[model samples]
Target: MNRPQYILLPVSPIFIAISLIAAFLLNLMPWGQFIAAPDFVALVLVFWGVHQPRRVGIGTAFCLGLLMDVHDATLLGENALAYTLLSYCAIMMHRRVLWFRISTQAMHVLPLLLLAQAVQLLVRFIVSGKFPGWFYFVESFVSALLWPLITVLLLAPQRRAVDKDHTRPI
Candidate 1:
């Protein structure tokens, strides 16, 4: 019997670590209610969803969200649930999303982000008997706005490499 060959994708530990650190920093930044920033952890999950889905999927999202829960001192599993759902959505849509232009992808991601926030709101309301203010949803909008910039910046190196590879003469 002949065995099939399996190819493994390169896992960039440095990139993953950098993404995690960036998420933590973004979370800790003192926005001071000026502008509600996107959940950087969510953004990183989306980045991984599009770029390295196999290595960082729903499990990573759940773990990161749990960490955020501990950090923020919110009811446990609130963000974890939201993040897990978001990661699953992203993973399911990853193929189609990868084909979209950055602008289009931003549009697509907006609803997903909103959905995640909405779920969190529901969970919070159920647990605490109070709903957060409108500003709570602001992060989703801001995240949508930042999506194009993030995608462009993150994918630049890969695009450059692909371009160079194609431009090389036979």
Candidate 2:
């Protein structure tokens, strides 16, 4: 069965910024110690990196990662390194990922999320000589699982109305 594709409106920079801030705030909540809590900032970074590579590239990811590092009080550049690589991987696969539905996009994102988490883990181990164990990876899995929900919520503002206007360009 073929599904009709709806054209999306151009996304606003302000909305993108707000979403990033909201994701950061979500991460800042008291759930940081919970093993099952997803990394909201990482998910949003991947989403934007894939959807608007030019607007949200490695630099943006790195900056956000640094903020996360400071917030977590971990070694500087731990998150920055992980997020920079995550943005790179997302940007590299953006073209292919766009062809799939949102559900499939989550599958595509899982490995990247895993890899980002691995990088962070490795950095932490190298610095502190400690491994947080398997539970450390739960965040990536949870983040991947939340991808579809995040996609819908973030894209809602950019979706055009059902009615079409001929004079307007999509």
Predicted model with the maximum TM-score: 2
Off by over 4 Å in 2: 162-170
Q: How do the residues 6-110 of candidate 2 rate in per-residue lDDT, one tens digit apiece? A: 678888999999999999999999876655899898999999989999899999899999999999999999999999999999999999998999889999999
What lDDT, from 0 to 1, does candidate 1 have? 0.80
Give the alpha carbon lDDT tens digit for every residue of 57-157 in model 1: 98889998898899888999999999999888888888988666778899888888999999999988988899778878888988899898887666554
Against the true structure, candidate 2 has what lDDT? 0.91
Tell me the spans in candidate 1 whose CA falls farther than 4 Å from its real position. Answer: 1-11, 162-170
Q: Cα miss at 86, model 2 (Å)?
A: 0.4
Provide the TM-score for each candidate, comma-separated: 0.84, 0.92
